[model samples]
Target: MSMPICIIVSPVQESADEAIEGRLHLVDSHDPQVPVTDLGVTRGDGIFEVIGVVHGRPLALDAHLRRLANSAAMLDLPALELEAIRAAVLKTIDLDEHREELSVKIVVTRGVEGTGVPICWVLSFQTDDHRAERAEGIKVVLLSRGYPHDIAARAPWLLTGAKTLSYAINKAALREAARRGADDVIFTSTDGYVLEGPSASLIMKFGQRIWTPSTAQGILRGTTQGAAFEVFGRLGFATAEVLVGVDQLAAADAMWLASSTRLLAPVRLLDEHDVPVDHDLTDTVNAALLDTAR
Candidate 1:
């Protein structure tokens, strides 16, 4: 049997003609041309966004731009000209020869010379995945509390809220799950408060209401999480940025990990506990979100 197909587009380019007001005049916005010997390659000096675009439109793009700028601030990179970046993205998608439904990753590396001094590149990749599974739900393994580096305090430095390229820990969490036979991992605080998945936000059910980890929980505010909560209001499901424990998760009628690509995956399994799926609630929420996404 063939393994599932995962799309990969490399060296995505940005427009050089776009004006940053100050960055450049009539610049071609070339891909990062720094030598393979650049210092950032060894020292990770960039920010990025894994955007999901459908029907040639980006989802929550403005929100993503806000987070991107925040991430750049956390890393002390140059101030990101949001409008310019947005235009570049729109232009890039228009240039994308492959038009199938795709998820695009928008990336911006700190300019090679100084902070916002010399941009490495603003790259975006358009991918095609036929086997993208909107999982029935997910099997989330609860991992240790708060980040190993006292993320609670140093999060501003680490940009917990910003979706940056420094995802070594995130990758390791996913690998640890794969090795142990699970789909994804959920980081939990010692008190059992849920944080988030390696790459997605944690959404759980509490009775007829919805709950997610608050900023105090040090979870990155997810775009999908934001969108879903909007639906929660319309659907009359009480939603809050509250902290939840595994026991609460086990007690809820449903659970899910929401993201752009995953959309809202019903989490049927969490660690050793097997959750009884509520297809009705899942279906309702999915339809509502899909409608809103459009």
Candidate 2:
């Protein structure tokens, strides 16, 4: 079926019968609804993943699903109905009709009041500005994440490893960067360790070695970062996962923020100071990242 772009608040369970066709598609229905009581809505209790869709096919499907499952596990949500989620994503893409590059977002919430059943759905939309930024490069600023580097190990309940829907802080960080005339933010620990970006992973090139913020440092395990490192190794680059400092980023040969949709966007400036961006390395690494088909 078809419907205008609207948010449907479904008091009833979303069903396949409500599926629609358009520039956007909601996986089991045209409805974009969940009850106000849903933990995802009221308290931002949920896990989500955004995946790149190229030519109507989701890139690194299994890896994405694995991360989704891991996110859910970290949140202590129910075991994911993997096959169902997979079907929803594919169906959402198939129904979109336009096969241009897109982003598929999968979200699973921690159930509403009175019903332990989780809320899960897939939404597909046109790719965002990251596509252009990947080519033009971006300016970044280092901001404090306000946590010590080892907070994740010391306090597991912080959900540091999970990609939860509670992104108010992340968005605020980005907004603050914009206010400062910067394009994005690279978060640093309160104790002066480089963490990551608000929504992307940090990869810095120093001499012959490539480094990413360690997951042990309370950062999300960046799927794109891992994939890029594999590609980099194949391209004859040595890589490592380390605890980096904000000072190191300022002096790196080159740096980038990596994510599924953005792929890899080089940092040309940080904190209004110019980074010695290696254009050749940037282009080559970006090419390798794109060629990974992820």
Top-scoring candidate (lDDT): 2
Best by TM-score: 2
Q: Give lDDT: candidate 1, residue 126.
A: 48
Q: List ranges where model 1 is wrong by over 4 Å.
A: 1-34, 37-40, 113-132, 145-150
lDDT of 2 at 290: 61
- Writing each residue's lDDT as its tens digit, candidate 2 over 175-260 gives 99999988899999999999989999999998889999899987888888888888889878899999888777766888899988
Residue 76 accuracy (lDDT) in model 2: 81
* Native-to-model Cα distance after best TM-score fit, residue 207 in candidate 1, in Å: 2.0
Clashes of each: 9, 0
User: Which residue segments of model 2 deviate by more than 4 Å?
Assistant: 1-32
Superposed on all Cα atoms, model 1 deviates from the true structure by an RMSD in Å of 5.5
Model 1 clash pairs?
A: 16-27, 16-28, 16-29, 111-118, 111-119, 137-266, 137-267, 138-267, 145-188
lDDT of each: 0.66, 0.78
Cα deviation of 139 in candidate 2 (Å)? Answer: 1.2
